[model samples]
Target: MNEVMDYKFVSKETTVNEMIRGKMRNIKVITIGVLEESTGIVYPHPISEFIKRQYEFYGKSL
Candidate 1:
């Protein structure tokens, strides 16, 4: 089983407040695709860690 990771460094409340204040800010949501070799299928996956990292990065910049 894949272990779930907790994003301790990022603050969701702060991110939301920043977005609310930056009325014209553009927010891009990205989802990574996971490929299953056995079935030769690609599935869209949304990883919290990956997305939160972006939020954390942007939050620090702000």
Candidate 2:
């Protein structure tokens, strides 16, 4: 089976305390996605490992 999982990374220019202090700053955010494959409709932890392995395999190919 084929599936996809979404992951996100966020960066804040100011700390929460700074924000509370009324400091204005720009916030940056980044997002990434990883496709997960499974043998069945439900994805188990083992299947997630498989996806990681696939990535490692292709990464080494480079």
Candidate 3:
């Protein structure tokens, strides 16, 4: 038997003074889905475009 789970990363941008004002930044939501096989192993989709985009951005920064 196997189980599957999903993960997501969300980011937000706000002014430094927002903390003093007790305000939260607008969240940019990113979702990632994973598949768990019968071996209890999880893997992300190969065709996922987000992963590719992120990798490209990271490589550029480096």
The top-ranked prediction according to lDDT is 1
lDDT (0 to 1) per candidate = 0.44, 0.33, 0.38
Indicate which candidate wins on TM-score.
1
Compose the digit string of candidate 2's lDDT tens values, residues 15-45: 2222425876653322222323232222223
lDDT of 1 by residue, 4-29 (tens): 32112222212222254647555544
Candidate 2 or 1, higher lDDT? 1
The C-alpha stretches of model 1 lying farther than 4 A from their native spots are 1-31, 48-62
- Which lDDT value does model 1 have at 36? 53
Clashing pairs in 1: none
Say which prediction, candidate 1 or candidate 2, comes out ahead on TM-score: 1
lDDT of 3 by residue, 12-60 (tens): 2222222325775543333344534334433444434456466745663
Model 2 spans > 4 angstroms off: 1-44, 60-62
Which residue pairs show backbone clashes in model 2? none
Q: Output the better candidate (2/3) by lDDT.
A: 3
* Rank by TM-score (best first): 1, 3, 2
